[model samples]
Target: MTLLKTPLLDTIREPADVRRLPQEKLAQLAAELRAETIDAVSVTGGHLGAGLGVVELTVALHHVFNTPHDRLIWDVGHQCYPHKILTGRRERIRTLRTGGGLSGFTNRAESEYDPFGAGHSSTSISAGLGMAVARDLGGGERNVVAVIGDGAMSAGMAYEAMNNAGAMDSRLIVILNDNDMSIAPPTGAMSAYLARLISGQTYRSLREIGKQIAGHLPKFVERGAQRAEEFARGFWTGGTLFEELGFYYVGPIDGHNLDHLLPVLKNVRDAKTGPILVHVVTQKGKGYGPAEQSADKYHGVVKFDVVTGAQVKAKSNAPSYTRVFAESLISEARRDPKIVAITAAMPSGTGIDLFGQAYPDRTFDVGIAEQHAVTFAGGLAAEGFKPFCALYSTFLQRAYDQVIHDVALQGLPVRFIVDRAGLVGADGATHAGAYDLAYLGCLPGMVLMSPADEAELMHMIATAVAYDDGPSAVRFPRGEGVGVERPDRAEALPIGKGRMVRGTGEGDVAILSLGTRLAAALEAAERLEAAGFAVTVADARFAKPIDRDLALKLASGHSALVTVEEGSIGGFGSQVLQFLTDEGVLDRGTVKVRSMVLPDIYIDHDTQARQIAEAGLDANAIVAKVEGLLGKAKAGRELSRAG
Candidate 1:
């Protein structure tokens, strides 16, 4: 009853430690693990419900299989908190998702237990297959399990992996955690059918009886019983989809029951056949009252009161960027009947929920299928509908090919409202939108723009709607917008133009900035001004076209030019540098050039400011780097005068 005080959990410093415990104590251990997970997430403010749902499953998997050698690949990895706690990270659980702390998702660098790192969904099967192939090539005997959610199963990549795994006859185990929900309520027919199949009590019981009966038969009888067993399985499991894909379909079993999970996993482990998919039914938030009642609210929470299950709200002067985008999109949809919205299972997260509510008939919630969402939007665009494909910058990576082939190549006017455009906090590197600007800009006829503030974002949105040429993207950051008063009328901004935020005349250093990080660059320029260096700051609205005239004019007049953006080195800054190179300004003039960008490595979860600081994109860091460049420029001038 006293789950938290159990000796089994207290003694567990690592998975190896748990392996030493008696099998009889595992149930108590599972209870203690769940309690620890709940307590840890209460302080750390991370994904709670999914982790709570997988406590028993996590324990059973680790107990039955030899990890660090056998390899367990967790899909999406948001549900890996219980997995993390069980795998030697128990003591550090309080530091989850914070700066310089434990990551919220599974990181291969974080632990040997995490064989394959994942933040995106529907990658487990592919990763597991890779490990299986590698193990087979090495003549090694090890079980490879890929635990993916039913939500993740909707993605085309999951089927691609299943199709390949079926053909290879690779010994891979894919666990489908059918909770019937991703972030919000599940979408599409696949989700509905999976929910019905897994929740059927009669089907599950009959399958178990059939397995038991098959086990009692003689070896010769069992050999001849293949067709009969397949028929029985087909009738009971009702998994023609996975069966057709070449996987041995099993279960619809209760995932929370360790007694059932352990035995089932053991039998599957010993089967020694082709790919096997075990469908496990689990509640999103199993035991905890608050989490179980509202799984979505608890999915990714802030620090909350453990007793009341209420989050501590942080006061914000302005609405979040997501909220603003949602409001603007909804308003635009109301005005324009031809306007519609789409999201890849991130309705609430991307603020498409508002558009969905306003235009219920027009909005589409494509479950965890970014690639499909992109192509679908293209189809909608071809039909004379203005479709806004709202997706997180990170998730947009899934649909790069579609963006090029379907949207860009054909020059379809699809508006891509890219949310969480910069360094996304808490979710860490796996969810950072550091590469979108660079990647999107590279596409021919694609228009890429980042807003400096909330008002600018609204303007960009209007501009995206007005532009009926090719694919256009308006990227905005995560969290609350800067407290700038939003304009009542959304106006279309001039395409391929830059805005001068500070300084009128030519200066020693011209700072060209992109995105919300422009605010930081302006502050840095102010500091440089106090130090007697006149710095001109410009917000480069369009990253693709590069605003060559503005950049050339600014660079031509300034003694030195410095480009700044929150994205990676190959982003907006790179565009400016490339322009300067193409214009032959570098060879013709004595202008010292410097670029400020995010570090190449993946940053961990923290506040956006902290992540920016770590990446050396903070105001102080920018100021120091610029001052050094200016000092060098002056030194060269002094040397030339002396000569």
Candidate 2:
């Protein structure tokens, strides 16, 4: 592949170099930066469309603001690829999202330029506000700027921050990157003129003078005067919402135009306003032909051909866990008219898009607001609807309070279809769904099921649909299922029941597995059997309402019992251990018990296989764990014989 010419981008090592360049040359620099961002993402396969959209904005921000000291915060950080390239990281840009390389999102540890690390959306304004307040308390003169996407504005947190920032006197600047859809038409010379005039020092001084004049008037008159001023400005600019929230609003400016972005950013940067919001509009995939044509495909991509824009996707023999869940749910919804699906701005990611295609009225995309999605489903469940709230396990953490207060406490039959339940590759620790089992298992009257395969996933979906007594969740991992023929008709399993997958006879050692780690346990059992030790393998099925009878049977029947799960420490293994202790199974000292779970440390971005191996949840790790346990058991036996 021929490298795109980035002549101007090659000369720049940092934002300081960007500042040194003349304004006329800055446009050329932005073009080079755009080309470089596309080329790098095409090679590395990270977030492309967002970064592409922000190329000029990034150049303008770096050029206008004294970054590193100024504290420029990118809201979601997927769009920070352009920012990353300009912030002395261009040399290593190709290593993005790879193991032991640059992160796909902004990471504070990776660079001082990244004041706050972000993988999730709708956090920049809050973080930037905190920084602004701190800077004021410290008597620092450094500016604080937050650039947030329009989609991120859907979350309540963004508005909460704005409300607080609006009420305060702390100097902060917020740039609303409205790329997906337009709030207003930002065109012609007149719009640019209005943006410049509104943000200009002269306009700000006159506005402050008017506020002073209003303060002297009667309360009613002051209120009327404020309304009139806001009405006049908002009539032209559509900033009344922001003005009411206590921010000096500007723009609906062209984000792609460096000429437009630079002057406005510089105005806000120097303005004495308490909090200012500049609305800048741009296209998601602005430059590259394929990306510009179909922004969604390039939003997140695999390593793609720079010329042809074709992504390199691996061939899969079986359907993905996400696809299987969607298909099963669609099948179930066909039979059940009350069934509904909800997703928090992740229709495609959670396979809710397919469900929507089948039943559009039954599907809801809540738009980057996980908390709202949870409660919305609760309301649906209250109205006799079987609402399946499909969310990534990691994203569900944002709505824990609603999960407890709204759903679980009220005994709402909200079926949580948790996708991405284990170590997610490329996205790293921020996106890892390692804590769902731990968080949800402790909730009373909650039914939690982890499927061992795609077929089991189908059964679990049916189980969740039938479980109308309380809140229930099914968590599956982020990749292709192990090839297993799915059942023709989905059958709901008995609640809290487990099935022994192998070794019917009472073996010397038993491996109790949960979630998708059953395949590893089975493989480990084979290795143990070949080594002249009998091994039994069973799938716990449910993390909560854990298979109590199976737990006792395994504890008493085996000399050594090793519990394995693809979750953190306080999950399935912990549940079993608690049950055994409570039941006097551990008091007898007849069997040695061990638990295998994900490691305490956060694993970096890598292949899912590599990450699971590192977490010691793989077949080899399970075999090693069993071998170690049996060694201790044999030693105890020998000591008893001598005694």
Candidate 3:
């Protein structure tokens, strides 16, 4: 337990406790909260930099606002650790991101303090706007505040909410917590803040008077005045961009200083405004030395040394899939001049940063905007550039409309390199890439492939690069490869083809494994062989296109056909089932067919092995399914004999 006994932190259990404390004591509370956040994250290994950055802001917001009644939404929820500790979750703070414990991100189900759930970026404004709208309808005076990050502002959704809120004239409070970076360094004007503009009372009064003057002026005069204000603001706060979007822009204030945060928050709470945007600039890792120095690396950490600030990572024998993708993409980019890489804020996570190192001009990081990233890649693809749109499986869901309308329907030859395509350990259901296969595979003319390991992923990368007919995708799971030997040069694997890994000329039972589940399929086949059942294993490289010849042969030859995939119900298993049905494979009735896919319900955070087993796609689960099916067949034969 990372529990600390600070005079200030110890007294607080809720927002009411925060309110009860004297305003002078808020600074001490923030310091204690920061220490507690670092200590707790050191043991549990969560989002340390973000929560550390917002320590003062969190205290101020909770203290000033009547929370649970008033809504406080933390965008992306990476900074909610301190918020959670102060809001009745301090005892379970260390249990964050573990199985049956508190979620790393803010979950509404977990606590009333969490008015809206957040995991993906840029959704807080939209959710908070809805809450504010609901409050208006319900005739409630409860405050609705959405604390967003500069990173989240990159997404159009945040702006859309702002636009709507501005037009509707909703009393919404938006705290733009600019840590000066998202995953990588901040891009665009989102990180720009006013230089000492909101530090003094004179400027605040002038800005308020200026807003009143601008509103009363004629349309033409207002435009002229707005331009002049923009020029003045460029020097003062650089918040004209937010102002143009219909938000009352305030600050470029020091987020670390409680003296600054407390009064601004109090003013915002008291002011009758339509969607106010308070620009608070804070360091990502404020108090902690190591985190402050190397913010990105410390953003998400494993259990680490609190004293030295060294992360305690387990030794791995294999290079991670992320690194392998980066290396392979870099190699591909060297040979092809047209090849371009794009990621939605996740430069290092997708390993696109390594590709950027090789070809800086060729790599584009769109920042928290998956929608723009997808369409931007589509535009490049339209221009005959080989744009590899790399995104994590879960994050890509945010841009699925672009994936369908812009890329797939238009038939742009965009290469989608879907990372974290299976159960991502620790990140849990919100971050799982379980639905990519189902969603992407269903698209017409979309070619979907899942690599069994790192070596195969290299080949898939090459395949995606060469394919120009339509949208093509390659999905690979999170973490390291299965220690396969790396090839000096990559070759494109044949489209719509599957390869047999085991069995002789024939076998009674056929196992068609997809994605990273091949290793477990082989393990299950070994178990089946020992039990006197001849088993064959085949790796279905392409989820789309189906590998008809191979699937038909397996079905016609084997007594039993089983499909295994690390995806949801509508993905690889569904594809196999639909294809077999269309081909009349099941009409024969002799082959007992089974499709193993992740269930319809969302599974919580657990070890990858445990998650797969729970999904019944693991080796032991597969073996059990096979034995049960065989046992049923034997009983049927015995009943026939008796009859």
State which candidate has the highest lDDT: 2
Q: Which residue runs does candidate 1 get wrong by more than 4 Å?
A: 1-4, 20-23, 181-231, 632-643
The numbered model that scores best in TM-score is 2
Best first by lDDT, ranked: 2, 3, 1
Worst 10 residues of 3 by lDDT: 182-191
Q: Tell me, what's the RMSD of every candidate?
A: 5.7, 2.4, 3.8
Sequence-dependent TM-score of model 1: 0.90
Give lDDT tens digits, candidate 1, residues 478-516.
999888999997988888998888997497888888888
lDDT value for model 2? 0.92
Candidate 1, pairs of clashing residues: none
What are the runs in model 2 whose C-alpha is more than 4 Å off? 217-221, 632-643
**Taking the tens digit of each residue's C-alpha lDDT, what string does model 2 give over 235-309?**
998989998899989988998888777888888888876999999999998899999999888899999988899
Comparing 1 with 3 on lDDT, the higher-scoring candidate is 3
What C-alpha lDDT values do all the predictions have?
0.84, 0.92, 0.86
Residues 272-295 of candidate 3 have per-residue lDDT tens digits of 667888888789899999999999
